[model samples]
Target chain A: MTEKPLLLLSNDDGFDSKGLKELIETLRPMADLIVVAPSGPRSGSSGAITSQVPLRCSLVSEEPGVTVYKCSGTPVDCVKLALNSFVPRMPDMVIGGINHGDNSSVNVHYSGTMGVVIEGCLKGIPSVGFSLCNHAPDADFSATLPYVRRIVANVLAEGLPVGVCLNVNFPDVPDLKGVKVCRQTDGVWASEFAERKHPHGDVYYWMTGVYVNNEPDAPDTDHWALDHGYVAITPTQIDMTAYGQLKRINDWNWNL
Target chain B: MTEKPLLLLSNDDGFDSKGLKELIETLRPMADLIVVAPSGPRSGSSGAITSQVPLRCSLVSEEPGVTVYKCSGTPVDCVKLALNSFVPRMPDMVIGGINHGDNSSVNVHYSGTMGVVIEGCLKGIPSVGFSLCNHAPDADFSATLPYVRRIVANVLAEGLPVGVCLNVNFPDVPDLKGVKVCRQTDGVWASEFAERKHPHGDVYYWMTGVYVNNEPDAPDTDHWALDHGYVAITPTQIDMTAYGQLKRINDWNWNL
Candidate 1:
């Protein structure tokens, strides 16, 4: 355990993504880094699997303590294949995505980026998802790497609890004030499809959205952290128990 | 609102699945049921989109109060098309699956059935995913109907809080047992690929798993409830925050 922990890295933005390159560059110096990620963009592919068909993984790079593979599958697929046979052993930690865009608040549910991290946490492994609040393919990640490496080092040193991981998002800014330990903001993406006509005049809609964060004034929220130029770290877990609604839903389902 | 609601139903198990049929039959009496599941099995398709090309949704059936559309896309796609234009107005309740499998515990992360529910929750619509712990194509859903209907009724009577939905699971058993409103069990699917050689001698790994609930004896868990023939209602939310570890992670991310 004292050895440089074998850290598995992945992302939704695919293997050649700038985010992955940045992540690999940052973490490669710290520990044994095993990078396995989708070869093509798998954004919004929330934990999907190509179950009916066979999937493939192409070896991309390797060094003494660094190895990378690009998978023709979802982000979770990369994690699974790595866990199954790609890695020399079970990874000490799994870090997904210095993501090309933010996966804060409700975005985590649809994020292929966070899906791999959640996959790792499901097995009780420490995991973290790093995201920058910039969507461009060549988004500004310089401001994000220092925080990503720092969080990874800390998690590696002080292991996360079973089923727990961190969803870290940074504001796309030059002068980050500090970091904020915040909760997921209460927000929802109202996806409005951009309707268009094809050559044959058939109508189709491209899915697009404006994220609507209803509760913005909440002091310690991921949205607030990003707004204030602080790295937002929301320690997330796979605990889906709606503690608030358990007894409230008793009237119908339980009475049966 | 007082009208018998427009119910959009789907499942990952294909349109012709027994679970889908049962669910449609169950909902027909209560609501204007619009069934828009995938054309073929989409068991592992989480939140994928057909952005590379245009997709199709063909009308399969049109009855008095029930209509079905077989879509060539993921569960989220079906919901998107419906929410965008296929339906007159947004569905009142979006129910994904009286699924032929359990989506309790960590399976939530891998479920296309639950993916639709989460999308519905994001859109501020009440959603529920009812799953039976049965994976057979001809699994009997008779045992699960009452609880399913009850939960649906309760949700309609009192809508879920925005961004939350009910993930209901039933044990594949005979006769009656009570329901348990519980927390997500600390469990994972220990998956191993069934490596098979094709006629062309290419080896492919088919995903298969064994459910390993580490907290088997924990009474308040979904796993325990399902094991005891009690229908387990896990009120799942999209926010994955483990609030206790936030400050620690924040400080760690900032220190570097």
Candidate 2:
């Protein structure tokens, strides 16, 4: 008999968030799980790492086939600490999220959920992050479970290409239409701050924005897929090199 | 006669760091400058945003051609805030760093320095991030001044592509070999934590690691250029899509 595959799980939402708890409940039967997640919400942390302070990781809960640890760090830091100190052996797969908010389109750039998977991919591990297009505290993920199982199973069976990980975003609907393999949508967040006068007569600002899609009509993009009630999976890579522009930049005069 | 170009400047190191001051001094003669940087060091912040807290921004210093503001936010936040609320108009270019440490190889994934430029690129602005391969508080940036000037001049005259930015790294040397337009090196940080016993008999960790380069012999990578004492300019993009793997993922039996 072979031992079940070991899966390392984390999320940008705190360890106790409904999204993460739902993920743990769904994945429990498939693998031996070691969950090291931030003790508090760390949304929008992106690929941030804690360097200036010593991190505290405590084993919060332990049960048959499941062990959970809460770390005082960002999602990326949790992944790093888990790989280096917590896991008993190299896990077969690294999974992030079942995030409480949408991580579609350019949100990946500002996502702590995606940060976990990116760190895992950098370590040459097969990684995937899942997000729902909902921000409700008790967002229903029931419709996403079967699709999640299928995708996870496929990734585990086939493995991902080196330097590539999956960014899967489920639309906030009662039922999913289907899954679409799509590219990241070209987009930007516009008018991103709200100015306010503090009680002390000082001006402060709140970070807020409206996403502006540059390619709204592109059916092959994540944004379009999600808008059509489909699960959008973008194969994200760690390399950010603009290879097409390298030659153009090289042609610039460099003589100083 | 054309008006002098406007440049928005920021850095991961706090507003008063020598690196930022050096950048300001060098570019003072070339254009009007507005500097918005974190009030405290925010290394390894990546694209993290400060949504949990209301950010305080203060105008700290004003001079003939230079104005500096310090904000209680990450490097990415500085760029967003500058564009949304601070700048008189969309700046001609957004520039980050003259950082105190290297941001080559996979360091870009965890770099607040690169976050500034990445945010700028997403906003469709020409952006560039500069980093020195030294961590000393008083690191010498004098040798890089001429090269910096040339690169800025070229970029101002010939704007970058819509979705691209530059990540430029200068080696810590008295004389530079030259410039190299390169790709990001494939690398990962290994053994990333040092376990320590807290005084209260609990385990804690300090994040530290050695970079492992997968392709040490790749002459066309940013890592190689930095190692060879050349100024490495890697054209970076905001798009994280793995286009080559799209067809491969689509071929998977995704039927659920």
Q: What is the TM-score of each candidate against the true structure?
A: 0.94, 0.99
Model 1: pairs clashing at backbone N, Cα or C within 3 Å: none
lDDT of 2 by residue, B192-241 (tens): 99989978898889999999999989999999998888999999988999
Q: Which runs of model 1 end up more than 4 angstroms from their true locations? A: A251-256, B47-52, B197-203, B251-253
> lDDT values of the candidates?
0.83, 0.94
TM-score of chain B of each: 0.94, 0.98
Kindly report which residue stretches of model 2 are placed more than 4 angstroms away from their true locations once superposed. Answer: none
Index of the highest-TM-score prediction: 2
lDDT of 1 by residue, A101-182 (tens): 8889888887888888888988778999998888899887887777777788788778888878888898999888877888
